[model samples]
Target: MQWIEIVVLALIQGLTEFLPVSSSAHLLLVPLFTDWPDQGLAFDIAVHFGSLLAVIFYFRDDLIKLTRAWVGSIVGSGMNQEARLGWAIIWATVPVGIAGLLAKGIIETSMRSGYFMGYSLIMFGLLLGYADWRYQRKFSANPASANSDEYHLSKTQIAVIGFSQALALIPGTSRSGITITAALLMGVNREASARFSFLLSIPVIVLATMLQSVELVAEPLPVGWGKLLAATAISALSAYLCIRVFLALIRRIGMQPFVLYRLLLGAYLLYCFY
Candidate 1:
């Protein structure tokens, strides 16, 4: 890939990965508008790995605490808030993992059309907007409780969010978007929901990267390592900044902007394709 393609794709991947906006939807538009060649599997893996790095690094401190607490509970130290949350993350990832394995082929083949993606973008955008609206209305009367604690979520709530994440297998549904929508629907506050969504991403990204790595190993495509490294660095820096800024501003801005953007983009796509 050219330097321009490398930079643009990397930045897009990083910026959209954690946002409610669908990164896959945005990336699909690249080749449609430009004459750029497909950003082969190697490059795809590199950028995602960079995103994985950003989330992991940003949550390093929390991960350390969670890891220790989780191990402690396993060895008979008993459960605490951190350990309990650790287990919740694990259980929450299971549904998406199974769904990906079972339905990935069908999703990639049947759901790659612009019409399908456009419909998904619009439909899910509305769902996200509704979820955000519900959250705001329920908490507007209680400003002090606007940032409710997520650790107190019931098992049913976690399972609902987890199962909802499987819907993200559709090209434009967006894993982060669906998970956040589910959390908001379950009455989680914006900040708490965003935090849990980001934490939940750690395992999901790892799983995606591993699956892609296996494919890359089997095909063994010739790749430009230098370009891949550059993509990784660019993606990592942008993703890290995105996480910091999003966490800082989500409580104030809410999800309306992203929802509106998705709607407009989806409409444009439908106009062009259907």
Candidate 2:
């Protein structure tokens, strides 16, 4: 890959990985539009690993606290809020993991069509907008309530969000977007919704990266080590910055901008593909 392709693909992966916009869709569309050859399995693994590293690094402190609390509760210590939150992430990840395993073949085959992705982008964009609007209404009526105990969630609520996250398997139904939409519909505050969505990403990315790594090892593709290293470093830096800025401004700006962007992108895809 040329330096330009490396930079563009890496930037797209890093920037869109956490955003409500679908990173998978962007990655799929880029080569199609640019007429570039596929970036191959090795490149895919590198960029995804970069994203995983970014999220883990950004939330290092929270992960430490959650890890200790979760382990403590498992050892018969009384469950506390942190422990519960930790358990929430674990339980919430199950549905998507199962869905991925069961639907992997279909998702990799039929669901990659541009038309399907276009419709998914529109459908989920509208859902995200509705959820965001609902959250704003609730926040307006009870401002103080929005900020109080943001991460506190009931088991049923976590399960609901977990199941909703499985929708992300579709080409354009972004993982972060779907999860955040479910959380918002459940009345989680913006910051909390985003935080949980991001935290929820850790395990999924790890699993995906591991699976791709195994595939790459089995096939043993000739990889450009220099390009792979550059992709990883560039993607990591961009992803970390994206996370920091997103968390900082999510409350102030809300999800409307992303929704609008998704809608426009979806429409364009539909027009082009059809």
After superposition, the stretches of candidate 2 with alpha carbons farther than 4 Å from their true spots are 148-150
Lowest summed lDDT window (length 10), candidate 1: 143-152
TM-score of 1: 0.97
What lDDT score is found at residue 20 in candidate 1?
86
Clashing residue pairs, candidate 1?
A: none
Against the true structure, candidate 2 reaches a TM-score of: 0.97
Worst 10 residues of 2 by lDDT: 143-152
Q: Mind giving the per-residue lDDT tens digits that candidate 2 earns over 4-45?
A: 999999999999999999998888788566988988999988
Which segments of model 1 are wrong by more than 4 Å?
144-147
Predicted candidate 1 versus true structure: per-residue lDDT over 1-274, tens digit per residue: 8899999999999999999888998998897789999998999999999999999999999999999999999999999989988998999999999999999999989999888889999999999999999888888877766655567777988999899999999988888999999999988888888889999999999999999999999985687999999999999999999999999999889999999999998887788789
lDDT of 2 at 126: 97
Best by lDDT, which number? 1
Tell me how many clashing residue pairs each candidate has. 0, 0
What TM-scores do the predictions have?
Answer: 0.97, 0.97
